[model samples]
Target: MYAAVTLFVFMCLTATSHADHHHHPCHSPNMTGFMSVMTLKGEVRAHGAFTYDSMGKKLRFRSNESHPVNTSIGLDVLMFFEEGVFYEIDSKNQSCEKKALQCSIHPMDIPDDAKFHCAMNLGNPSIEGEGFKANVWTGDIPGKKGVYSMSVTMGCLPVSTIYFMDSTTILFSILDIENEIKDPDLLVVPSFCQGQPLEETPEGTVNTFYNEFI
Candidate 1:
């Protein structure tokens, strides 16, 4: 259970980094898409549907995850930045765990300090088919011993992100993104999660993926 919870938090942190540049004309402040995450060492794998609302400071991730010792878990996390809390829900068990947000929530956008790596085509660009032209950015994770590389389309659609931390490598990929969130209540905290006492407060500076980057 501890491992599962840790993975859930890690996944949530990883998903927070998306594509939005103020200088760029195109940006995705609201998006819903499929997300897949995996570790290079094959220690953990998760895939799910996610909704991100940068304007609303909310996020929702419903995922089926497998990790540490081949345990499978189903989790739904709803994050509310304004409330400074997040709820971890187990739909099958009708249980919810409320926890304080360990790190300040920021918009799901590339950090301004991120260095532009290059602009390249993400796929085959042929006469009959034009591939996605994307900009790549790299940055060191603030207050953490890691670095991240992100690729996004010219229109500010997230393509992929790779985080290198210590000796572990994690990859995050998004696909089939819709620029508008379809479900109006997707970010709402479930009734079961209401009035629950905070279960834990994560300690350590390395708990967040984009800590202090803003």
Candidate 2:
């Protein structure tokens, strides 16, 4: 009886450990993906492709942004955290604007303080192999009065994110994520940006890829 009880206890501990491991936060630091932002009213604010290299502390975003008064514009933005600068390039007119990197950089990963909210299936969960499994996490945005939630696949691929800010609700959908950074050159600063004077912008007015989180 004693031996049987000991075996049962060991088995229980092993099962608990396995469950914890399965729910742990996992992410890929270097990846390329498509990202879109929309309002709660379903208006798409911007859609773009982005490449992130956390190890090198750099990111690139090619965005097609819609404006309330002006026509849609395509812009390419490159951010180098190590140099504390960012460049905005207008490809059509060959204009580049350089500015100081004012916003804090948030990594493309699950935050350490994020808590596991639930497990969900992207499609029909009852049907085997029909859809992918993902985990949802929620946490408060640091230094902000907001909550951020994200869903990621079992392989740590981001599916979507939602931000609840003071007066706005934004939804970010991530798709077609490739776990590898195919073009290392995408993070390089363009030659057009060289020797450009840094334009001074008001604080908290700089719109950046990572600014949505903070």
Q: How accurate locally, in lDDT, is each candidate?
A: 0.63, 0.65
Which digits, one per residue and each the tens of the lDDT, describe model 2 over residues 110-192? 76667776665444777988776766667786545787777677777776667667867666677678877889888877677
lDDT of 1 by residue, 85-124 (tens): 7777887787888776654322245666776665655346
Best by lDDT: 2
Please provide TM-scores, in order, for all candidate models, with all chains considered together: 0.73, 0.72
RMSD from true fold, candidate 2: 10.8
lDDT of 1: 0.63
Residue 207 accuracy (lDDT) in model 1:
27
